[model samples]
Target: MIPALRQDRGQAFPIYVVMVAGLLFLAFAFFAVGQASATRNGAQGAADSAALAAAQRAREELGLRFPGVLTAPGGLDDIFKDEGFVAAARDEAVSFGAKNHADLLPGGWQPHPGRTGQFEFTVTVQTQYTVGRSVIPGTEQDHAKASATAVIELRCGLPPGSGGDNAPAPPPVTITCDGQDVPVDPLPKLEKIFTVKLVD
Candidate 1:
């Protein structure tokens, strides 16, 4: 009877060992998946932030140069081609990407297709940190990347006859929005004039 019992215990021990080993492997696999997901989410967040920051910076530039845009000849065309405008936008993109633990790839900031005159910007970023060692192979050296697009669309408009060739706009500019008057000077009420958002 004692020998029979001993043999039964040995058989059960091997089954238990196999079950524990399988469970540990599953746990490691799940942990690796979680790590990968975290990296991907971080990359996406950085891209969205960088794009929005760039668009917002461009919006501010427009507000600062709003007076010239209204009175200068070919003003509408000139502001779009302004080197300073593009530079400011790119600076903001790079700054925001760094803040979010990512790097904006070269030429990663570009204009959106079929969407001219919207102050549109698309930003792409790669995570500064790689996914750490995991159960999955090659994950230790993997870096996540993501892209997002944000736009600064004009929401508020100037007063009637405030725009056009050689038409002088009156100030302090009284822009109306949501049933209230927003002043456009001493900072041009830019937030009121433009809506900044992530489109992609």
Candidate 2:
């Protein structure tokens, strides 16, 4: 009876070990799925940030900083017409994919004007990320999709010299003594009055 009990105990231990291993494998799979989802969300957030930054930069280059300026009202419209906001958004989508590690998806842009000269451009970026194929065996293919929309508005306060009438001041003139003759700066005033006779 004692010998039989020992043999049964050895068999039971192996079975218990196998069950524990299986449970651990399942737990690891669950963790992997959660991690993949988090990573996908992070990529989407990055895409949103990038799109907004690009739009802001484009608007800034177009001189859309001030609201009350005569050009500010139509500044975004001008940008959309001249620069093509939709195209810029598409470029941004590609950039986001490279920078954020996601597959680029469909997106678009729309121009909307706010109170006063404030202009806003709505930009949307969409992307998908593939995550988790292990543990589920046949369910290896899964995609997480995300979409981000941003409203980029022109900043208030006109930049320096934006509407100001102050032209660049005239350059200063310098006179130097060159031993043989006094050298005057090349200015219209000096050029008009001074004439040189060359002996050589």
lDDT by residue (tens digit), candidate 1, 1-200: 99999999999999999999999999999999999999999999999999988888888778778656655554344455564776888899999999999998877889642244466788889999999998899999999999999987665544555554555444536655545666655544677666788884
In model 1, which runs have C-alpha deviations exceeding 4 angstroms?
A: 74-83, 113-117, 165-188
Compared with the true structure, model 1 gives a TM-score of 0.84
Q: 67-174 in candidate 2: lDDT tens per residue?
A: 222233342233334444445555564676557666554534444543342334444444354565666564346655555544444322223333333332222222
Q: How many pairs of residues collide in model 1?
A: 1
Highest TM-score model number: 1
In model 1, pairs of residues that clash are 184-188
Q: What is the C-alpha RMSD of each candidate to the true structure, in Å?
A: 2.9, 16.4
TM-score of 2: 0.53
Best lDDT among the predictions, by candidate number: 1
